[model samples]
Target: MKFNEWTIKDHYPEMALQDIQPISLRAYSLLNRNISALGPNEGAINLLGALEMLEALDYHFINFTQIEKGESPINQKHEAVAYLNRLGQLYFFTKSRFTKKYIPDSESHMPKVIEFISIRHKNTAHRSLDSPQKEPDEYRDRQAFTFLGATTRKFLGNEQYVFPNYNKDTNETEWFYFTPAIDHPIIMEQSYNLIEKIIKELLNNL
Candidate 1:
């Protein structure tokens, strides 16, 4: 489905109104300073990493949106995993580099950002056999396994996949199923906002 037709567009009108090229150029311009002049002690290194991750987030977002309905399940899953991975990495940079002065953890959207991070940690970054009981109870029962294309179902025939979880209790571990816990566009929008705030703050400091 097209981005404009998605319900998420209502919450992020700027996505439709503004072109990404200018925003990307602005971000690049802000980070284009000489690293040697800034020195090793400066936060330029962190900002550079954050900037790279931010660009990656945008790339994955665009790739996912461009995917056609009824496309190859492999392609669909690839975009989904890629987008979520970059989302988590960018959020990490925001917190570790930007700090609360720029983007606080108390923000309403932070929970969603952290959720994506946890999801990536369990599913992609560090897959495990058993779920760790943690504060975010949602992932407590989730196990780490390869997400097969057969396990994915399209969301309203869109590029998005609604992953279902398998009933592992039956001792049949051949399949892994998952209920969809993410709103892709909403998280993408929120992540972009946070990253933008961090980039602006970094530029101001520089």
Candidate 2:
């Protein structure tokens, strides 16, 4: 495939709110940079950057609204599930009220994506003082992630929104999927859309 390109709008999508969180800002930044730096030497580094980028995006984002209210969870899995729950809540409340489907469920990743991210966070994102698992193969080679149906979702008439096509016979959304380099966009898109959704809610409702 050819290198990805971005338009002016892609680079600057309706200037972010004054009080936007760092997680959202960071994700947009990574996506912009990675998309721009698609080349031989740079692409690999950008991919790794994208990997670490999503760790922060998901880790910090899962805490977005809940953190200030003291509703944050200690475990990554809990935080992730909470994030998905909030998304579903928002969709239910807003979708019927608004004429437009402004926030596509496609933007959000299946919650089980947290399992892949949590490990990456430990290995690279956090880089613990205790012990972090660092192996050459993890980065040098493509990695695979498989998630069960519990964390997956497939909305009818929404096939156009799905990213990273899945095999119909052995779909993770149905049962499980194993694929590499799948975490960044999933985490980034949900965080990106969530931030926009929050801002819109404030502007339209408040």
Q: Please name the candidate that would achieve the greatest TM-score relative to the true structure.
A: 1
Tens digit per residue, CA lDDT, model 1, 1-206 = 21122111122334432444434433544333323233323454555565566567667656766778777757756766886677676666656634566556625556566655555665655434454433233333344324554345554544444332332355332222222233654554565566556656544655
Residue-level error in angstroms, candidate 1, position 2: 40
Report lDDT (CA) for all predictions.
Answer: 0.50, 0.35
- What tens-digit string does per-residue lDDT give for candidate 2 at 1-206? 22243321133445553333444454454344444444222223323333344444455344432454344223333444344343333233333323134344522433434433333333223323333234333322222221111222334421111112222355322222322224334544554554345334333432
Worst 10 residues of 2 by lDDT: 157-166
RMSD after CA superposition, every candidate? 10.6, 19.5
Candidate 2, pairs of clashing residues: 172-176
User: Which 10-residue span in candidate 1 carries the lowest summed lDDT?
Assistant: 1-10
Can you give the TM-score per candidate against the true fold?
Answer: 0.56, 0.25
Candidate 2: residue 158 lDDT (0-100): 17
